[model samples]
Target: MSHTFSLSRVARLVGVPRSTLQRMVKEGRLTAQNGEVEMEELLRVFPDVKWEDDGEYARVEEIKKKAFAKRIFERALPDKEVLADRLFDLTHEYATAKGLLAHYEQLFEWVMHKLDDVAEAGGAPAAQAVADCKLWLRQQLAAAPREAERARGLLAEERAMRIVSVQVKVLPSGHEFFVEGSDTILEAALRAGIPLNYGCSNGNCGECRARLVAGEVKKVHPHDYVLKEADKAQGAFLMCSYTAVSDIVIEAAVAGAQDIPHQVIATRVKAVELLDERLAALHLTTPRSQRLRFLAGQRVRLKADGVEGEYYLASCPCEDRHLELHVRRDNRPFARRVFDGLRKEDPVTVEGPEGSLVINLDSRRPVIFVAWDDGFAPIKSLVQHAMSLELAEHMHLYWVAADLGHYQDNLCRSWADALDNFTYVPLWVDGGAPEVAARILDDHPDLSHTDLYAAGPAQFLQHLRDGAMARGLSPRGWHAEVLA
Candidate 1:
């Protein structure tokens, strides 16, 4: 048996920054005694446990790494998302028996023994790692009648012949859907395209709130952000807030669905060789068989296999068949792949043409598009699409890049020649352009009334929003993309 450690020691076992580990304690995100936290509590949050001195932890991690490599080598899966990695991570944390840590460890271990080697636990693939966890769980499960039935019910072998229907409704949109999972609604929704809006979907964000119209639901995780007495009276609930004790009908206010276009398809890519290193100007084609319809400046989700992530569309109606995706390699999961390993003809999927980040072309006053770096993707598509309709003329794009060579000459020179009304301004953000926005305001003092389409990091996007708002621009008149 191993000795329990303090919060500081457990924090080291988990990769969370010390500050966040501390917050988890203060916020009661995890339970602790005095200044000490169980290694097991830490494990429940993070599955891949590492002991400061235990050889077992390293051995398990190395084994997981090898399994991951083998999966990728066989092309069975792509890279894991930052959050998804955390799922399997929890499978490795262990606690001493009979303590608060016992149940978490036992439950995790029981799950490991009954599944295949390639199965995903919760949501991440950690079948082999989970298998190692079964020993202790099996013994305790035999003594706990109720939980034993619940755990066994989740496995196919445990109940392969049974089938059930589950209904779900998307909030705000009210777009209703259905699914059948071996376990919970959260798992089912993820399998379906609709993910419940959540931060730490473990019920921390209060972001996953929904209405439980009828039937029963149980809180699986200890969520203190319970529905207020008033809201609960009205039938609203948090999807991650509960597990259905009985078939449940609930409503959750889903995010990410405003003015989002329909049927976004993506294919093809163009390598902007002159752009920054590992930077590629991907010429994304809508479904090759059909034309993808989206606003010039909206975004879409890029999916490869079962894993999906999002990107903005850089093409417009005029460029109907061809879309553009400006991708840069910065070591983010699926994104890094598109920039580095993915190529033309590689099959990919696209979801809702999303986001409301575009100029109201009807405003019609030689609009200005301000973008930084790859943020130019949607702007280029919008400009191209708008010029074709004459709804846009005398359009000016002011872009800030690391340097001048970051842009392709054909893309620039062609816009100048083809659309006499279209203009381009490229600034070097790194070469001491004190403030690109300030430079633009200085050059075009008439900035007082120019309609702008801005997209970039939260800081840059907010900078434009604040400056424009401060200059007396109505909030509706100035548009910026919401990336967070």
Candidate 2:
């Protein structure tokens, strides 16, 4: 029988993004049956792929390691029980295949004996014909197919992948991520930049309960929140406490910006990075059990040394306990404190992740992000979020540097260099709002199919909105926040 793999598994085995595979299917360049791709079809579609080389997969893993520092790979391997279960499943499959091979061998022997009997009864002509047929069958069986080596490599790689990490698909929202190492479903989801609804991440509040639609799960952490017997029978489990043992489908909730609740987390000053003489990046780390939950592009109120100020988060939510804020050397209380003397390990209170200018997770259109001066803080967060999601068809970033002087210019350039779909343009704030807006808008004459996110002064945003609308951008496609 031919092997068939799910889209997620196929993407991993081929070292490509799931979105790329989906697009190929949509464009008729590839074929899939019921969301699974046959092994023959996969080989036909990607003939040049060197299945033995895992460069692409390794690159993605390194990127994830940098992005999700502590939450990723707490252990080098999965839990022992989960590993055993996976091994058991693989062994069962091997045994079944071995049994089938034995059965086929017995059938071949029986066929040979019947041919001999027919030859003995029918005489010399019939015996010669039977001998020729048996010789052809033996030759065909002995000759290896052209794809045999590549197919063997692919199967070996996929089996290794299955043992190391399991793919997960969330229902309703259709978001997919992989559970690697010893990560629970909730942890993996958050690391992927997906906001799954939960209260206490330790599984006391029961908010992380989800139903298993398919596959197996192993409980790695004990939860105080108890499920009813009926619920257990229905495959209900806490996402924060269970790790997947195989590729799984789950019915769970994906949160939007509004779905996240306000949180007051007592965080410590991890470091103070001086980007320029006029700007500083304050790094804060929350307690292990009480990580602040917020979407990208949101502003938080930070209080330190009896003073507080509101600033936009410059870090992606996927960064686990680490939170980053860009503080300009202004008269604001927190900015003054950060510039003056915010040492490492100092106490800081973070509260109210208040802002609606978040990424639209559902949109797959090309994105244009415009940031003015220090407004790049939120824009940077949004850009990282978009990168983690990998949902945008293309991304264009235009930074109109004013006082901050493109402090993170290298970072932007690195993003552009790393991603084929990303582009970065740094501009000087020479003329006023209209002139700058016109200059940026001049690049794209047609904005109807694009999503534009701009963070700047109110006047600049107004000019940008008016110009973009005039250039066929729908009102729904335009999103802006006044940073001034």
Candidate 3:
């Protein structure tokens, strides 16, 4: 006869959520009849389920019942040597002595009876035989701890010889992934093809912030993002900065549909032109089957001719199967190649469509965009995407650069001239200016109902954020992404 259990009971026994069991059933990993499941299938699905002593005893009883039949006299049992060996094996398998003793009490009694039977009827007394058995039992008990310790040492050695992996479960979404010893949770999730919200990967933006529901993790790196103390106290951590030490559950904000399903594709450069001496626009086309799907304002990792770097998508997603990237000719080798050496029809590997800078279409609040230098790349994409949405909310853009000539004022002015809901302002500030924040605050004194997005130098963005907070801007409403 086989033991059986219900789906809910199996879920409880395996320590997984009932919904997960349901999903397994839907996926055809499990089968049920009237909500009942066979014990064999349950064990097969989760082979690592640590059975308690009572559970082990029940299993043993089932095994014995299947192996034997009742008789008029008592059935012959295993010899003392066999019974003692089984008891030793049980002790080695179980972590606690209480459970082992409860499960093997009958076997122990049989061993004691065998010792008493060793004495002849007249030669040795039953009391002496009992005393000898007790003495032998005491000796075995005295060595039990040492034997357990030796067994643990062997187990530890075995573990050290193999790579260890820990399970991480993301809440709300119920996405699960395994993090190996050397990988961060964010890295593991991405490797497992799970899309998680993250930015700067170095832990500066707090975009990958998650709350730890349970389990231990060690911080792998330090983050400069100023997380609220209240959030810190409640177990918020940067997924990119921590590695799991044990199985863990984290409550991470799930990314929107538009923000996920990232991929790496080989794209052909359709055209390349110098926007100016410092900036070049590269047009790329993906293969018909591998057209990239990405939100406007996201960034991609571009690799060509042994050079790789991250560049923002300057074009709108409305432009199908094509991507436009604005590359700045900086001291970096990748930038130099893109600006001076790369040509049309060159094969470039593009990875990502990442960044948490996409617009929140649900908000009806007026929008303000502040861009500095090539920070305009993402801002350009954002504006284009917003325009395609046909949003009626008034939108204004402040374009600032080191020199007035670099602001791409003409391009923005064209949008202002073409769109009814758009306004563009260009400014040049060569050095640090206290008046920049003051001008913004003066223009938007009542920012309580506005959504302001500032992108540029880290220090400059921080300054603007501080000012925004001081002038009635809700911390949650203000969005800032630092450009390094």
Q: Taking the tens digit of each residue's C-alpha lDDT, what string does model 3 give over 23-114?
A: 56767898777556775676567565553323432432233222111101122332333334434444554556576677688787787777
Ordering by lDDT = 2, 3, 1
State how far residue 236 of model 2 sits from its true place (Å).
1.3
Name the weakest run of 10 consecutive residues (lDDT summed) in model 1: 70-79
lDDT of 2 by residue, 1-484 (tens): 7999987778777777665676778789989987789999999998988876655655655555554443434546888889999999999988998999999999998999999999999999999999998999899789887798789888988988889799998998878788988899999999888888898988799999999999999899999998999999999999999999999999999887788899999999999999999999888999988888999999999998899999999888988898999999988877888998899999999998999888887788889999999999999889988888878778999999877799988778777765666799999988888899999999999999999998999999999999999999988888888986
Error of 1 at 344 (Å): 3.4
TM per model?
0.42, 0.93, 0.47
lDDT of 1 by residue, 1-484 (tens): 3234444234324433233444566667877775556544544565443323334333433432331221111112212331233233333322322455678777665656455444554445465455555545566665776533433332222112112333454444443333333334664454333434554456666766777777655554567775678887887666654545433457664434442336645555433232557566566555534655456677777787555667776654434255566666666666667655676577677777767775463454557777777777777656654443334335777777752243554565456544445677877775343366666666555555567787666766666666666665666667777543
Who is ahead in lDDT, 1 or 3? Answer: 3
Candidate 1: TM-score?
A: 0.42
Clashes of 3: 0
RMSD to true structure for each model, in Å: 25.8, 2.3, 22.8
Q: lDDT value for candidate 1?
A: 0.53
lDDT of each: 0.53, 0.87, 0.67
Residue 228 lDDT in candidate 1: 78
